[model samples]
Each structure stands twice: as structure tokens, then as C-alpha cells.
Target: MVSEMSKKREFKDDEELEHGKVVKRFNGLPQFNLQRFCYRHNPDVQSSVGSTTCYKQDANRLKSVNDKISQLPKNEREEVHHVVSTFRKSNDKLRKLMLEGILTACCFPQLSYVASEVQNMIRIDFISILPQEISLRILCYLDCQSLCSAAKVCRRWKTMADDDRVWHRMCEQHIDRKCPNCGWGLPRLHMKRARNPTPTRCTELITPWKAIYRDRFKVECNWRKGQCVIQEFKGHMDGVLTLQFSSRLLFTGSYDSTVAIWDLCSGRLIRRLSGHGDGVKTLYFDEQKVITGSLDKAIRVWNYITGECISTYRGHTDSVLSVDSYKKIIVSGSADKTVKVWHVESRTCYSLRGHTEWVNCVKLHPLSFLCFSCSDDTTIRMWDIRTNACRRVFRGHVGQVQKVIPLTIIDIENLVVDDKQTSDPPTDDPHDPLTEDLPYPTHILSCSLDNTIKLWDVKTGNCVRTQFGHVEGVWDIAADNFRIVSGSHDGTVKLWDLQSGKCIHTFQGKSLQEPHDQQAETAPHKVSPIACVGIGDSEFFTGDEMGYVKRYRFDTT
Candidate 1:
């Protein structure tokens, strides 16, 4: 029992020694040493205990110094006290300089071992003196992470960083210059007039641009990391051929002879429009109506709200392969080797006969003045909607041109010349007739069954770039200003940089097979071909030949 007691006593001693060592190590740190020195040296320090003891010592020292001055001659004491008091109340810049000088002096041989507590009292007002405009311009160069850090400095900095204009400019420079929530670049005047009959005063509301940027940034990070919520839509019994998306609705056309409207948020079937005599091949929609073209060689316009057919356009002599509409104008490509433009309200049709084989895809420009079409004859043709004339023919694809889409043009200040070269110096006069007559220089993106995607200059009719990565035919393609997304029979979805024309990412789908897996090798390799792709602000949708539609969110860690 004595031995056990002695062991316990020794253990307690060792434990106390270990704790003392820890305390000694902590006290040796520069911050703690500075506090200890201040407490020991300051004349007015009353106690050397607690973390804040040095602060109280500073106050006491000031009082002690003033008491010494009080003992001097009356006129001398007043002058000295006045000087000390004024020095104490000076601006922070002078105080920081004095503190730094003290720190430097303390680094000398005799005082080197001592540390001062005055460093913590110094502050720098780097941006407060600058004009707000210049300050904002400097802040604009900071990326998202640095800007977020700058917001935490102080109340003034927070207010300046959170200015809506600053955030709006950031969104324009980084994110697309569109409402991240509504996906609209600018609100349409006609939409307001059509909704309200009394002609109410339309006022533009300032959006929460910072919040929008945060949401978009989070979604893009999600995409890069492959973090997404998977929801499978299984209404179509056959392959889905085409799809279109708005903020709230998803419209899908299928070979099952039906067009289904779905609640995009819930992924639930809202209604089915089934009037086509054959498989529905292509579809387009706006806030008011939906137009679908089918293998029955007819284009039908239906009221989306009521699911009632409003008008049937019967001009194509063969299967309508693709269709696009903007406002009252509609363009359709048919297997009869012709492209037709129709005025939806007046029912007037104009034929553009150029391709010798089936016209597989057609796209109308957002401006409604130009149309682009691709055909199985390995050619893409641009049409002028006003004159109903073929303006240019682009020939590069060696196989069937499956899809064509216009590249979103954000900066059109410099135009591309006829030789596919950019003009070095932009024309000075904005109203130059020669520049105006140059027919808005744009680019077209086309994918073909030749396992390649090509970028063409519309004004030059030259293939400016060709991107090749797919092991099989490239079937469908979609693009924004920054990236091009393509779906292929290779059972993979790829993301390409639009500017550099380099494939950056390859996304594997369910149909992708492992090369070395015996079980996968025994099964059919080409069971599912990606047929259509649709892109939203945060996510993208791809439909395969198995009738599976997938929504993948963006993630980057």
C-alpha cells in the first residue's frame, strides 16, 4: 500500500511538471512575451494577472505620467500635458508610425529581448481616402474569393463591396450577362404590354446581382465535382428526339407520337399533347404556345396552356426533321430536301431549295432575320429571312450534318473578314454604310456523323475550326458563349472550350462500357445513342435513345 501511494505521488509530480512545461512554452511566444513585458515595465500596472491585465496597465501608466507632469511648474506642466494629450488624440496613421518606430527600436541589442503590446493598436485605412469610383474600379479586378474576403474588413468596406453596380459588373464579366434566375438578358417590352392591358408604367427593378452570382458560382462548382441530384423522367415509351426548356417548363418530343410538357422543378408530367399522326420529331415553345413538327410532314401549333391545336401548317412534302420558331416566323427542314419559312399568323410559306438530300436540322437566329440549316448532303446553308434567299453555303462535314446552332455573340465590335481573319483596327464610324452592309458577322457551330464538330464564319463561309474527339458519330450539340457541349454515339457527353476548340471534359453516361470487363464486353456496346441535349443556366439535360433524360448540375471544388 505504501508503494502504491508513493507511485501515485510521483505520477502527480510528473503530471504537474508536464503542465508547467506547456505553460512555459506558451509564455515564450512573441505575443504572450509582449503582454508580460508590458505588465512588468508599465509604471501604472496594478496587477500581472489575466489576459487583459496589460491593457489596464497601459491606462495606469498614462495616469502615472500625467501625475509626474502635475508636480512640475504650473506653466511648464500645462504645456507638457497639452502636448501629450494632443499626441494621444492624433489620427491612426501617426499612431501606426510611432508604434512601428517603437517596434524597430525594441529590436536593438539591449531591448531586443523585450516585446511591446502597441502593435495591436495600429490600424491602416488604405482605401478610405480614395474616391468611391476609383475604389470600385480597383475592386473590380478582384476575383470572387478575394472580393468575399474584402467584405469582412469593416462596415465601410462591406458597404462598398456589396454595391449592386460592382456585383452587376462582376456578373457581366464572369457569369453571362443575363438574369441568373429568369434567364433573360433584358426584359421584353412586348411581354409586359401583352400581359397588362392598361399600359402600366414599366419600371426596371435592380436585381440582387451578388446573390445571383453566388448561386451560379455554387452550381458551377457542383458541376465540376459531379455533384448533382439525379431525377429520371420515364413517360416516353420510345426515344425522345428533341427537347426545349424554360425556367418552369420542359417540353419533350418523342417518337411515340406525343409531346409531353413537364414541370421542370418536380420532373413530373404536367400534360401530353397527342394529335400527330406519326412520331413527333421536333418542337419549340414560348410563353404562349408550342409548335411541333412530326413524321406526318406537318407542323402544328398548339396552345400550351390548353393543349389545343390552334393551327396546322402543311408545306413539307416529306417527314419534318427539325423545326425552330421565333415570334411569328417558323422555319422547318424536311426529308424532301428543302427548307421552308412560314409566317405563322398569315400562313404564307417560302421554300429554300439548296440541299440535294434530307435536311436534318434547322435553327433560326434569335434576331429572327437569319436562318441556318444542315442537311445529310454534308453542307450547312444560311438563309436571309427577308428575301427568302440562300446567302451562303458552308461545306466541310464529310458525313451527314446532324445539328446546327448559332454561337452566342457577346462582343461584335470587330468583324471577321472574308478570309476568316479579324479586322486589326475597328472601323471608326459606327454609321459606316460599308460596315452596316457587311451582314452581321456571326459564327455557326455544326456537328456531323463524321465524328467531328466544326465552327464556321457565317460571313466568310469558311470552316474556321474543327474539333475531333468522339470515337463515334457526333449526334447532337449545344452551346453558350463560353462552352460547347456535344452528345455522341460514343456514349459520352463532352464539354469543349468554345474559344480554343479543345475538349476539356468527358462525361460518362449509363451506356458507357468498361473495356476490360468481360460482362460488359459480352453485351451490346452501341445500345444507347445520345440524341438531344438542352442547356440551362446551372444544369444541362441529355436524352438518349433509351428514352432516359438526365439532368447534370455543375460542380467545381
Candidate 2:
């Protein structure tokens, strides 16, 4: 019996060992080895042993503990179970903390990058961070008024906004193609001062583009609102026939047989050019000389600055009605039913014979290569100066053709070529030859006694559009890219949209007490016929038969 009992005890021990082996493989800890249990379960402990060996030992220890618990009394077993459950809960909490720490370490670099990007965005300054060239490019998109308002934002912006390059672009857009001060179709001086300054005669009076644009804007506002400072230039004894304006000077020719030069700003008569023996029918002037045609069958050239007669050429058989000049070449049209091209230096003349009746107006192309003349023969003719032959004859006007002026073109092959060759740094200049090629009326604007104004494409020799609003004969017309202004014997000044061929507004002389207070909706006043018209940057000047020169500002309001 003792031998059997000993054998049973050995068998029980072998079973316990086998059970522990199973637990060691399946569970994380071993059964009932106190040291192994404490080492595996302690949250503060770290093992240097291989992980698999440690896990096996821990499993065996746990199984031994569970076996001991099953062998104990039920109450003691329950108490031991409660202690194990508490340890497991503590271990789970510790595991969660460690997992969180590991995850944070792994994500640290990415989190740091995100934080830096956010900070950079918060500190960014557009004007300061961007290069000046890029900043100017962005600002260029704003209109004149908006750009001026942007200048008041801060000192940095103000400095950039005041750049001559910026203002130069604005000036090109708003100002006339010709420079007011220099009288050059394209000003020769640099639009913006170069990094290295080049000496030129006009560079000293470099166009103040910023000031020019600002003043022009103010003047435009005055025109739109009918708020103008009217200065009546009254010195003519008879009817004022033709007038031309420079920046500071005004020249007028009249039936009084005299031509008067006035200081435009001061309204003072600077000098009287008085050599014409009969009524001065028409006149043309540039920076150097003033040339006038007279009813006395003479063309007189005068020094505009000194008011001295330089020379007189008498060739026409009848009254000289209109004259134009470029350099030393003079082109005159007469009631003698002929056109003459003269070389002032050589005293040589070439008579162009085409018109069967009186020629009323003649204009030389900017390059002096072509001449345009309108005559009572009801034809508008373009003459080739080099060959002295009529090239194109426009014949749309039923009545006598009154006036013809060149319009801006989409591709201005003629005017722009001369402008580019004569101007500096053809690209940056506000007078860029390409600018005149914008989609505007770059043809010929002609009015007639037929009470119609026609836009004729000189290249195609076709009438593109015809505008009709005047009740009487359309006496005179002036145009820019945007609008065409016409003056008529109807005693009205009409503004027409060049693109739409629509009359957008009308100014009646009879409705005005004076040009300044003439409201669009006011009652009509007694006025005389408009004999002549002159268009400026923001204003237009009209001369009546009564010898009154009325300056009208453009007002939208």
C-alpha cells in the first residue's frame, strides 16, 4: 500500500509539471514561481533576458499559482483570485501609458513640422516677402484710383506705389499718345529713369508721370461732373477759325487777319503773329514753327516762340484754305482746286492735281510720308508724298467732306514704326508703339456737310461705320481711342462711342449760361454755330462764329 501511494504521488507531480508546460506555452506568465511572477508582472521592472525565455518562465509561474489556488480552501482561493484581478487591472493601466508614450515619440517629428508651417503662415508679409518686381506686377492689375488708394495703406507700399514705372504705365493708359510738354508723338526720354542715367535735352524735364496721371484723373472727374474752371480767351477781333494747343501755349487764327499766341495757364496773350494780308483760313504748328494759310493766296511760316515771320511762300492761284507741315515740308490745299507739296528749304513745289473743287482741310501723316486732304469735291484723298500721287480716295460723304483725322489701329504698322524708331527703350516706354495698336478706332474719322461722320479704314479703303446724329452738316470731329466728339452747324457738340457707332451724349451751346455750369438737362440758351473743334486730354475747345472760344470739360455726372 505504501509503494502504491508513493507511485500515485509521483504520477500527481508529473501531471502538475505537464500542466505547467501547457500553461507556459499558452499564457504570458509561468505558474506559482514568486520571483518570476514579480519580475514579469512588475510595471517598473525591465528584463535583460531574451523575450521568448522570459515569456515561457512567466507562463509557468502563473500556472503554478493557479494550481495552488485550486488546491486551497474555497474562501482563500477567492481571496487570491481578487488579488490577481487587481494586479491585472494595474498592469493594463501601465500598458496604456507606455503605449501612449511610444506613439507620441513616433509622431514627434511630423507634429513639429505641422507646428512650424502654421507659425510661418501666421508671420508671412506679402509685400515684404515678395520681390519688388513681383509686387509691382501684382499692383499693376489695379486701376489708377485703386492704386492711388493703395498707396495710403503703409510706408512700404507708398514707396513702391510712387515708382516711376508704375506711374508711367498709368500715364500711358490715361494720357494722350503725344507728350504735352515736348510735342513729340513719342517722347524721347526714358519713361522710367534707368539704373544709370543718360543725358538728354528733355530728360531734365522728365515727364512727371505720377503727377500727369493724377491731374488727368482729376480733370476727367471734372468733365464727368460738369465741374470745370472756365477761362475765356477773348482777344480775336473777328471770327476764330482754327486753334492749336501745346502744353502751356495756345495759338489761334482768325478772320481778323491775325494769329494770336496765348499763355494757356495764365490766360495772357503772349504775342500776336500778324503778317497775313487776309483772313487766316487755317494753321498748323509744332515745337519750332507756326505755318498759316491765308485768303491772300499765301502761306506764311513764323517762329512760334519769337512770333517772327521766318518766310512767306506765295504759289496758289486762289485762296489757300488749309495747310500742314512736317520738318521742312509744307502741304497746302486751296480753293484753286489743287494740292501743293512744298520743300521750304529748297523753295520747290509739287502740285498734286485730283480735286475738282476747293480743298478745305489737309493733314500730313506723322512720318510725312503721306498726306490726307478733304475737299468740296466730296472726296477724301490720301496722297503718297514720295510719289506725289493720290493713293486712296474715300467717297462716302454725299455732301462736301469737312475734316479727316487718323484713328488708332489694331496693328498700327505706320505710326508705331516711326514712334519706336524715334523713342528710347521702345519696350518700357509708355509710348510703346504696341499700345496704339489696341482695339480702337485706328482708321480715319471724317465728317461732312452730309450730316454724317464716317470711320474709314485706310488700309482696306472701306467705310467701317457711319455715325449720324447732327441735324445740320457735321462741321468738325475729334477722336481718341474711346470716344468721338463732333461739332456741327446744328450748334451742338455730340459725343459718340467709337466702337458702337452710338451717340452717347450731346452738349448744346444754347443750354449753357457759361461752359462751366452747363448742365446736361438744362434749358436751351441762344448760341451760335460751332465752326471749329479741338480735343485735348480731358477737355475739348470749340470756337463759334461770334469769336468766342468755349472750353468744355468731360463730365459723366
Candidate 3:
């Protein structure tokens, strides 16, 4: 249908390109405004001769041309003048031809002279010439460090680089998620969603976008550098089992069979809710209420502020080890080796049985109507809550699996996977195959009594990565977009870079901020296992068997 000449198009030296004609036609040429060169913006700099702040060198340039023309012999000068007049009168192509001929006739020295003169005459400042919107778009391509450096370049650059428009995009790119381009992550949504209502809280909601970025960036740096001042909350009498904190409150469940609420900032106990007949094994909370599972074979919801037992649900035949809720739906794991899905509105319960041993943990991902459970059977199962059926099984741990969490890893740097042949094939499913409209987590994080933490591929049921550092069993792990905080029975709390699957820092103590006073009632507990860990933007909290909760805060310093 097409001729060879038509398909194999030819281009002329003087012809302009399509789509990007303007940029290609004059790219690398000195920038100009009207007829004068933009000296400050133009990279083709020259010695100024009575030039103003505008940086024009037109006076010296015209003088140099005139002096050269006048130095030639009279007849030669007249001939050159005639040729120049004709060249000025001819078309662009003809002028180019004349210049080509002149350059071809020049010897090495003359050509070197020409090259030296033209070298600095072709430079351009492309960004300076672009419009504001286009220039901001270009700046958006730069990473945080590069943008900061660009802001230091000049007043104009600072103005544009510090603009809220640019930083807002930066916030969206990094905050609560990792930037796929830079692989740099900021704070997670948990940090932003937790609003401290105390008057001591800063006006972060009204803060400038750049200020927000700077603060979160500092927090991330502190986390990576292991720079933090830890504060201790010590009031629980028995071994602390589960703990979680928000912006202003810290809730801890303990072996004392009581759930204690404390002011997160001051580390002072607010109240204690006692309803469970035995040791509290797990606790989770949102805005309105707190939920806890206990070894008494009961799950209860409480109004933490009023210390009231709002309701109690009993279904598991054995001790309830873990519990999580989203609205009216609650999921719990028990020593009975089964998981129960409780529908509060319908007042009905469904039991999911698969594990051969005790189920240590259960986490509900309500968005996808999914649940994850780990057991003493050394395996984890993902269940479709809607159908009350097991969707997938993850088996790699040699010891009992203690905890499991579903995660949507935006940028997994080095996926930790088991090399051993698994019963299920390694597969990637970005979308849920069972439900076309819903999405599911790509990976899961689990810790075991085997003394390791593993990253699992959800679809393939393969252990993609394993993090090994704890000398004892890993009890719990909490993660955000950037980092994972794990507590171990080795009496240590370790922070891991979630992307790299590497341990960044480890706290090796009874989990104390500093040495206790000489007059204290008791010495710090040694080898007291950290039973639970919680993380935020600028801080992480670890609760140990010593009945102590240590808040490692990076923002303080």
C-alpha cells in the first residue's frame, strides 16, 4: 500500500522536526527576550562591556565585528563587504551554504579560533525560559533531596520549588505510600488519621505542605539512624500481652486480666476495664470502642473512655487468643484450633476450622472481606469471610506461627521468598481472581516461634522473604508503608526497613528508656519477652512481659 521512498522518509538539515519542532529547532541555543540575550539566564556567557544587570554584551560584540571588518586590505574589505551584503539579502539556506564554504576553507588555527569563540555562545537555560506550570511539572520529576538542592540554587528556583503545589504532590507520592520512582516512603495513613485532640498538639492540619514533608522526612531519617528518646509507661502489675496506641491514648491488655487505658503523651494510667475472667491475650481499638480477646474463652467490647463493658461475645470452646473487628463484623482466633466470624447485627456466628492446633492470631481485612489466621500448626490461612471458605494456605514456618498481617506492599525492594518447592506454584495476582470488582493484598507478613519473620506471596502461597535476627521467637510485628517493628522473646525490639527486608536497628534491653533509679521497688526485668509492638509516623511502642510499655519517639529530638 505504500512506496519505499514514502516509508523511508528523508530529512533535510534545515528542516524542523514534528511535535517538538520549537524545542528541537533551537535546543541548546542561547535564550533571548525580544532582540537582547538573557545574560543571567543564557548559559552562553560572555565578557560584559558596559552591560546592565540584564547581562547583555551586544556593545562589545558589534565593536569586535566592526574592528575585524576594518582591518582587512581595502580591495579585500570591499569584496568581503559585498559578499556580506549579498549573504544578508539571501535566504536562510543560501546563508548556511556560504558559512559552510567559509568554514571548509579555514585552516586548523583559524578553525580552532572559531571553535573557541562559538563554544560559549551556544548555551541555554531551558528551564528558565519555560512557563511556570511547565517548569513546576519539570521540578516534580526531582526527588526530595534534589528538590531541596534546587531550592537553594536561586530565588526563582526556591519560590517554585517551595510552592505548595509541588510539595503537595510530593506528599501524595511519599506519604502513606512509597514512590515507585524513588523507592522512598514516608509516614503511613495510621499516623495521619490519628488526630491528637489535646491542646498541646500542634496545628499540623493547617501547616504548609513543605513543612509537613520536612517533618515526616526527619522522622524517617531518625527511624533509619536509630535516633530516638524512649519514654516508659509502667503501671501494669502482670506481664503485658497486647498493646496499641493512637495519637493520644495507649491501651494495654495484660496477664493481670485487666485492660488499662493510658494517656499516650504523659504515660499516665487513665482507667482500667476489667471484665475478662482470665488473662487478656489481645487488644484492638478504633475511635469509639476497644475490643479484647482473653484466655477465658470470651471476647468483649468496651467503651474505653467510660470504662464500661458494652457487650460480650462468647463462642469459642477454648481460650480466645486474637481478635479484630471492622464495624459489626468481628473475627477471632482461639486455642480450639478454629476461627469464628461473628455477625453482631444478625446475632449469628460461623466457625472456620482448618488448623490442627491452636490458632494464635487472626487479622480481619474488611475492605476485601478477607481474614488471615495463623496457628500452632505452623501454617497460615487466608479465608474469604463472605463465603466462609479457605482461599489459600501459607506454610513455611517450622515452628508455630504466632502472628500474621496482610499488606499491600507498594514497592517491595527485595522480596524474601522460600526457595524450597511449595505445594502451590508461585503466582502473582494483583486482583482477586474470585471477585472481579475487589482487590486483595499481594503479600502477607508472618512471624513464628521458629525465630524468623517471613514475607509470603498471597496468590502463590510461597514464602518470598525471611528476616532472621531475633535469637528467640518473634512475638509480634507492626508495619507501615516504610518500616516494620518487631518484638521478640529475646527481650529486644527490632525495626526493619520493610522494602529491603533487612533489620535496621535492634533495641537490646529490658526495653527501658534509661537505667532505673536506685530506690525503685524492683529491678528491670531481664529476658522479659516483648509481647507486642506498635508503630506510628514518628514513634513506635513496645510492650514487654515486664509490664512496661516503651515509646521510642523520634520526633522529640
Candidate 4:
């Protein structure tokens, strides 16, 4: 057998070649024994040799270390080579201490600080040692994901990995598990539903989005008078494109990956219903069902009471933009350049195809069983439900209409009752008031990518009022007979007086201009998408691209 000293020297030479350097000793210090230093230690060898075995084992250990050094990456190989070469030049006492430190780290495999301290002790003379159990306890406090990665490196770590309580402790640190009996202490076993009660994916840093909330946004004075106060809801993963409201609830459809429901009174999230593989573009709801049209090319009907999805209707090959429900018919608009009608009860499908571009919005004419759909094709078509044919194509908006606001003839008659009741309102009865007739101005109000909101006389195919003030494209519009509320990419909620063709008030929810990708010729900053809006007569909710919803009150009086 080769002498241990010669073997160590030969292995070291091979390591130097692998690392692109040669070892040079000037101060007669010893080098590290790599195998014992990083992998494991043998205390029995030190006992068997008694005294001289320290030197004999050190020689054999240094050979094994030189072999391990050859396996490291070229940069790391160079670093280890430089460290060993430079340390060998140091004095004998320092050399012996370095070898002993590396040996001590190998012997006490349970201690992480021993290795860390040895690395530190290599540079300094008198390093202090903390108790091994205390250091192990500290290591247990690290995150589960990080601990698991470290455990894969060696056998000693593999033994420590057997402790099940370590994972539970990590879970306790990261997640808030609901427990009825235990309050902020070691939780008691209790029945409660909480989200993601386990440590899963590693915690990644979230990039900061532009600040949307600021002090300058004054709450509209009219909100104080109402019993219900509105709050901004933000948790969706993407941009919201549509909104709908029921008696006590609000529904939002988003380009973000899911559809969300919120309690209007308490502003608490009810649940996020996820089955849509893509962004939800439109939302509609009734007493029994809530429907969402998604870019996933499918429409889903969810049971409103049970919060369970009843059926998924799929036929469109491209993004579904809008869905509207009538008595038994569910009309859907899609970018595939077609409109589909599904019988709500029976689920029979009928398709209407005439638009050249993507259809953006669809609605049923209230008095008649007629259906109207607007498209990026720059035309709105009125379809005859009975014939399944296009009755008339209303050409008005210069760009794609984002929403078709249907004003039914029946709603106008109801408005007449509301006008009469409100006008002569001094009766002892709380329900009864004045009754008068007001002329129905327009049957439909349509907003478009053209930066205008047009009122259309659906029966006559005439444009009534083209209200303009939004500097950017209008994504969604809501209205009564007197006023129209629009949400624009310019980040403002604007109220327009339909009769006077004037903007009543602007709620600057997002008051700052953001930088554009490419500078505009005139305006440097590009406007963001307001995305969606929902409103009652007095209060309106506007959603932005960053999943923020701002509640505003319109100064209607």
C-alpha cells in the first residue's frame, strides 16, 4: 500500500489540476480532511490510535478530502484549493487548530453551528461555542421548505428529518388555523374551515404594484345618508371585467383567474368559485342562478343558494365576452364572431352568426322578444328570437361597443309610475306617493371603445345622445333614465346627464397618471383599464386593473 502521506500528496496534486492551480505550503500548516469534514466522523479511530492515531487518521482524512475537492465545481474547486494552499503557508499551531476544527465538526454531526463555527474559526483564533442542543433548537425554527432542502444533503440531516413535530411547528408559524377553544396559543382540536392550513409552496416575494388608495379621494357626501356603507374589495388575482348585484350581494367577474362574491352590507368575501380555466369576462344573476362567461370558452351556471356549480355550457371556440338571461333563453357573446342562445331549462342551443369581429355585449329587448348584440365589427345587430335571424343591424358606434344597456318599454312604464309616485309624495302611506308619466328617452345606452356612450332608440334605430367626456375608452356603463354612470380606463367614475349631454361629476378614484410602455405623442403616460363597474341609483362601484374596487356616491340631487 502507498504511504498515507504520499497518497495525500498525490490526491492533493490531482485536486490542484482539477482546480487549475498547484498547492504551495510556506508555513508548514496542515490541510483539511474533506470526507470527515463534510460527510461524517469516526471517533473510534481516535480512540484506537490513542495518541498517534490523530496524526495517522489526519493523513488518511486529508487524502479523502483532496478526492472530494476534485468533485466540486471549477469555481468552488479553485476556492477550496486557494484556502488549503494559503492555510498550509500559515504557522504550525494555526495549522493544527484548523485540522482539529474540521475534525470536531465531523465528530458532532448533530450540530450545524459546529461546521459554521469551524468555517469562522478558520479565519479567527478564539471562537466561542454555543451548546449543541440549543443550536439544533434554533435550526428547527427555520421554514419547512428550507429545512427540507437542507435535509437532502447528508445522512445526519436525514436522521433529524424523522421528527414530525418540526413540520407542524413550521405550519403553525406560517398559516392561521382557526380553532374555537384555543386563542393565539397551542391550538385545540376544533371544527373550523380555514384556507390552506398547511405549509405548501415556498414564500415568494410579491412585487409592489402602483399605489391605488390615497387621501385625496373624498367620500361622496350622499353616502352618509344611506344605511349601507360601501368599501373597496381587493383580492382577485386579475383584472375584473364585469359586475352584477342582487338584493344583499355583489358578484364580480374578472380577467384575474376567478369569479368572486361579496356581501354588500358586510363587505365580506363569501367565496371565490373557481372552475373557469381562464378569466371570467361577464357575470349575470337571478334569484336562483348566477352565470359567468369566461375566456376559457365556456359558460357556467352556479346555484346561487348552494354555492355549487350546476352545469357548464361549452361550445364557443374563443373567448366568451357576455352572457344575458331572459325567461328561458341564455344569450352568449364570443370572440369567435358568433352569438349562441341556450334554453335555460332544457339546455338546447341555437346560434346567430353575422358579426365579422368579436361580439362584446348582448342584451334582450324588454318589450319584444328581440335580442341585440354589439361587436368590434362596428355594428350592433337586433336578432329576431322567433326566426333565429338578424332583424336589423344598427350601425352607430365607431368602435367596438363594450356593453349594451337595454331599457325595456316596461321599465319605462315603471319609471312613469316612479315619477308620478315621487312627484306627488305627501300621502300618509309610506308606499304610495305621486303618479305621473315621463316620456321614455331612449331604449338602449351603449358604451364603446370609441370613448363615447350612445343612447339608442331600439324601436326606431336612431342615436339619441352621444355623451362624451371620458378621455380613454369606456369599459362598462350603468344608468337610469336621468343619468349615465361610466367607468373608464382613465381611472375615473363619471356621471353624465343624458338630457343635457354634460358631465355631472367625476370621482377621481385613481388620481395619478402612470408611465406608458411607449410615450404618446401628446400625453406621455398611458391610461389604465378601469375594467368594470356596478351601480345602484346613488352608489357606484368601479373596479380597476389591479383588482381594486372603489365605492363612490353620485351627487344626483
lDDT of 4 by residue, 35-142 (tens): 343212223223222322443335565778989999999999999999888786877689888877766667455466566756743441100022334434654665
CA lDDT of each candidate?
Answer: 0.73, 0.70, 0.81, 0.64
User: What value of lDDT does candidate 1 attain over all alpha carbons?
Assistant: 0.73
Worst lDDT window (10 residues) for model 2?
42-51
Given candidate 4, what's the lDDT at residue 393? 66
User: Looking at candidate 2, what is the lDDT of residue 124?
Assistant: 27
Off by over 4 Å in 4: 1-230, 408-442, 511-527, 554-557
Candidates' RMSD to native: 16.7, 23.3, 10.6, 25.1
- List where candidate 1 sits over 4 angstroms from the true fold: 1-124, 131-134, 154-156, 177-208, 366-368, 411-441, 512-527, 555-557
Candidate 4 C-alpha RMSD relative to the actual structure = 25.1
Return the TM-score for each candidate structure: 0.68, 0.62, 0.78, 0.51
Tens-digit per-residue lDDT, 499-545, candidate 1? 56778777776565556778886687654778888876566788887
The TM-score measured for candidate 3 stands at 0.78
TM-score of 4: 0.51
| Model 3: lDDT to the true structure | 0.81
Per-residue C-alpha lDDT of model 2 across residues 1-557, encoded as one tens digit per residue: 55555455544322333422312221222222434454444221212222234432355556777888999999998987986675566765786776566558767697788678558435423543355777787777667657878787666677777777887776664454433332222221223333316646754333466655655556555544446544577888887888887667888888999998888777888899898889898889888888999999999989988778998899999999889888889999999989999987887999999999999888877553678899998999988788898877878789999898876554233222222223322123343222334342347879999999987766556676677789899878877655578889888888775555678777775333556764634665556777788876556777767677776654222
RMSD of 1: 16.7
Residue 522 in model 3: shift from native, Å? 21
Q: List the lowest-lDDT window of 10 residues for candidate 1.
A: 186-195
